[model samples]
Target: MRSTSQRSVVIIGGGISGLASAALLARDGYDVDLVEARDGFGGRAGRWERDGFRFDTGPSWYLMPEVFDHFFHLLGTSAAEQLDLERLIPGYRIFFEGHADPLDISASATENMERFEAVEAGAGHRLERYLDSAQRTYDIAVERFLYTSFDSARPFLSAEVVRRGPRLMQLLLEPLESFVARRFHDPRLRQILGYPAVFLGSSPGRTPSLYHLMSSLDLTGGVQYPHGGFAALIDAMVDLARAAGARLHAGTAATRIVTAPGGPGRARATARGVQVRDPAGEERTLDADVVVATADLHHVETTMLPRPLQTYPESWWRRRTSSPGGVLVMLGIRGELPQLPHHTLLFTRDWSANFGAIADGRVPSPASTYVCKPSATDSSVAPPGHENLFLLVPAPADPALGHGGEDGAGSSAVERIADEAIEQLGRWAGVGDLSDRVVVRRTVGPADFRDDLGAWRGGILGPAHTLRQSAFFRAGNASRRVDSLYYAGSSTIPGIGLPMCLISAEVLLKRLRGDHSPSRLPTPMSPSPSHRPPPEGTIRS
Candidate 1:
C-alpha cells in the first residue's frame, strides 16, 4: 500500500477545465499530474495546422474575455502576457435571404437597435426593454447562481429564486419564439433576436429563453479572440499549469478506475488510481491521493469505474434530454471572403421544424448554420490572400446520421445528414463554387466528437439546459457516491461554454482545498523515488 505521506493527484482528461484545475492545484503547491488521451492539451480547443493554414477546428467563438482574464489574474499573471487578444468590432453578422443588407451585431447595443429599428420600425425600444430583462438574468446568474455546484435546487428554493428565478423562467419556460413574438412585430427583427439560440441546436420554440444569456456575454462582455486563434488560450493555461509544477502526460488514456470498498455501493467507493493505455498498447497503473475526472461523466461512469461507483443509474441518463451534436467543416479558402466578418450566422427560414426533427430523433432539415471567418481579425491564421472558414450545423448524437453513410464513420444515416449539411451550407453562403475555391477541407461530425472529445453520444454540452436539468439541478460538481472523486467541465455544474468551464474548475479547486479555506496548499517538491507505476509488466500501448 502506498503511504499517506505520498500526496499526489491524478486528473483524467486534459481539456480546458482539466488544464485549469491542474494549473490552480499545481500553483497552490500540490503535487499534480494530468493525463490526456491525445498527443496535446486543449481538448476541444485543440488546433490543427496544415500547409501554413491554422484552424481552431473546435470552439470557434470567444464570448467572455473576462473569464480568461480572471484565470490568468488568479495565477499572478495576465492572459495578455502570453496571448495577443483582438477585440472584434462588429461582434458578428447575421445573413438572411432576400434582405438588402445583413445586420452587424456590435458592442454598441444602442446603435445596433437603431439599425434594427430603421429596418423593422419600433424595434429599437422593444430591444431596449428586452435586453434590460436579459441583463437582470445575467447579473443574478453570474453573481449568485453560477459559482456553486448545483446537485439540487434546494439552495435556490427561496423567494429570491422564485422572483428572479422567473426572470430566468421567462428565459426558460417560454420558447425563444414566444419571447421574440412578444417583443417584435417584424419577422426579420424577430429572426435576428431568435437566431443566436440556434447555437443551442434547438428551435426557439423548443429552446428556453434563458439561453439568451449568450447575448449578454456578447453585448456586455464583448467578443474577443486570441491573436494565434482559440488554441493560444489553451496553450497559455497549459504553460501556466506546467510553470506551477503540474506534471502532464499526453497521449495517455485512462481505461479503468480502482475504488475503495463499499461492497459494490457508490457511497463507500473512493477513487484510488487508474489504469492507463499508452500509444503502444501497453497498460500501466498509477495511484493518487485524489482523482478528478474532467472527462465526460457518462463515459467515466459507464466505462472507467465499476458499476457501483456510478452516481445515478444508466436509466436516468438514457431518459435525459441530451443536447444537440453537430457537424463542423473547416476550410482554407484560396481567396478572401470580402463580405464575411469575423463571425457570421446564417439562419434557415424554418428553425422550429428544423429543431423539431432533432428533438424527435431525426437529423434536422434546412438547419441553421453558423460560419466563422477568423482571419478577418487574425491575419496570421491564413497565408497571404487566403481565408480560414469554419462552418458548424447543429445535428444530433443519433448514430443514424454519420458522414453521408457511405464512408462508414459511424451510422450511414448520420453521414447522409452531413452530406445534406454540406449541400445546404454551399447554397446559404452563396458560394456556388465552394467546391472549387476551397484550398483545404476537413470535416468533423458527431462521431469524431464522440471518439475525440469523449462526449457521451457526442452531446457537446452534456444534457440540454432544460428547466428540469439546469442550475443546481444539473449534476453535482463532486460525486456523491465516490470518495476523493470530483468532476469538472461542461458536463458538470456551471453548464457549458469556455467561461463556465473555467468557473467549474475554480469550484472544484475550492472543494478540494477546503470549505472556503484561503490558505495556499503546501507544495511537495520532491515526490518519493519509490512512488512509480509498477516496473513489472508493460503499460497499455
Candidate 2:
C-alpha cells in the first residue's frame, strides 16, 4: 500500500459517488477534498423541503440495502446502526388494467409465486424457473462483473469472459417482452414482470433480456426504505466523510480543470487542479494529486476538460441516448388516502403506444406513472393527518418535444402536462380526484432537472441501459486522456441508481491506490514555473 503522504486527492461533484469516495479514502488515511456545484451536497439524488412537505427530489426508491451497508462498513461504521433501514413488506404494488386485484410483490419468492399464480393459472412454477435463471445471472454478474472497472475491453477479453460469453448472450438475446411472453400467458402478469424495465427508460419489447437482472436485484436483495427519510442516509454518509478528515466545500461549483503535460518529457496532460467559482462567484484553485469527477460524464468530458484532453467527441455523444429525461410531481394531500401502499406503479393500458409517442416527440399515450405514498409508511413527512405523495412520469429529456428546454416557456407547458398526468393517475388508480385534494404540490420537469442538476438534455440516469451500452460497454471509470483524472457516478460503471454510484466509488478508490508511484508526481501539470528549483535538498533515497 502507498504511504498516506502520497494520497492527497480531490473529488469533484458531491454526489453519492464522490462522497463515498471521499469517505473511503479518508478512512484509509488519505487526505481528501470534496467539491460540489450546488448549494447542498446530494447531487440529483438529494432532497428538498417545501411548504411543510419533504421530498426526495431524485431516486424515490432504494432497492439495495446491502450496498449502502457495505459502503458504511468500509468506513468502520454500519448503516443499520446509523440509519433505520426498514424492509418494506409486500415491497411494492403493481396496478395493471382489467385485473380485479393489483399484484403485491413480497420479499419471499414463494409468496411472490403465490401472488403470480393467483393472477395466472400455473404461472407460479414457471416464474420460479424464470427467477432461477435471473438469479444465476445476478449471482455471476454481482460477484465478478458489475463491481469491476472496464478501462478497456482487455479485462472482458479474458478466458472467463470468453467462457461466460454464451451465458451473457443468453441472458440478453431474447428481449424482455419475448421472454416474459414465453413464461406467462396473462397480459397483466406479463406487464407486471416487464414493468421494471421502464425504470431503464426503455420499453419491455426494446429492452434487452438481461434487464431481468433488474428484477433479480429487487427479488434477491429486497426493497427497503429509511425510517426518517431518504435524506437521513445522505446525512449519515456526509458525516462519515467528515469524520474521516475530508474537507467538504459545499455550494461550490468547479468552473474548469486546469492542466499541463504530465511526466518529464511532456507525454500526457495531467489534471493539476480545478478553477472553482462558488455560489457567490468567488474563485479559488484546488490543487491535488488526482481529480475524481462524479458529475454528468458528458458535461465533464465536453465542457470541463480542456479541448486536448477530450476523449469522446461531440459526434459520440450525439450517437448515444443513454438516459431519458422525465417529469416528476410531488404532492401533499390534505387527507389520508385509503389502501394505498408505500409504492405503486400505475401503468397505462397501452404501454407500447406510450413509448412510441415519447420516441416520436409527441405526448406519450397512456403514459406510465409511478406513485410513492411516503405517508403510507411514515406519516411524519407531512403535517399531522395529511398525506405526502410523490409521482413520476417518464418523458423525453430533449426540450424540442415541449419538455421545458430550448424555450423559456417550457415550464408552463410542463405544468400543463403534470396537471393532465395527475388527472389520469387519479382516474386510473381510483384515488378520487387527487389534483383537487392537493393542499401542497411541486412539479419538476425535464427542464427543471437540467437547470438544477446540470444534466445534459435533462437526462436523470446516464445513458439508456441498453445492451449495446451495458456493463463494460458503458463509459469507463477511468479517463482515457488525463493520466490522473477518473470518473465515478451513474454515467460510469456499473451504472445508475444509489447502489451503483457507491460501487463506482469503490472501483475508483482501488485504481487510485493501486497506481501510486513517486515518479507519477511533479510532472509538467504543476502550476509553479518549471524553472523553479526543487524544494529543499534531495538527501535520502
Best by lDDT: 2
Worst lDDT 10-window in candidate 2? 517-526
Error of 1 at 392 (Å): 0.7
Q: Given candidate 1, what's the lDDT at residue 9? A: 78
What is the alpha-carbon lDDT for the whole of candidate 1?
A: 0.73
lDDT by residue (1-541, candidate 1, tens digit) is: 3233335678999999999999876665456789999999888887888878898977877766766677777787777787887788888887775564677888887877788789877888877777877777776676567766553455466676777754665566787788778878877788877765655534566667877666666655557777889888888888888887678899999998778775554468777888898878799877876888998888887888766668855766887777788777777888877777898877666666777777777766777778889999988899999988877777776543554211234355554554566566566667666657777766777777787877878865677766666676678877777888888988778777788888888778767645342222222222224333323332222
True-structure RMSD for candidate 1: 5.2
Scored by lDDT, model 2 comes in at: 0.74
Candidate 1: worst-modelled 10 consecutive residues by lDDT: 518-527
* lDDT agreement with native, every candidate: 0.73, 0.74
The per-residue C-alpha lDDT of model 2 at residue 9 equals: 71
Q: Which ranges of candidate 1 are over 4 A from the true structure?
A: 1-6, 98-100, 151-172, 200-202, 262-266, 403-430, 516-541
Q: Across residues 170-235, which tens digit of lDDT does each residue of candidate 2 receive?
A: 767778889889888877778877876777756787778887867776665567888668787788
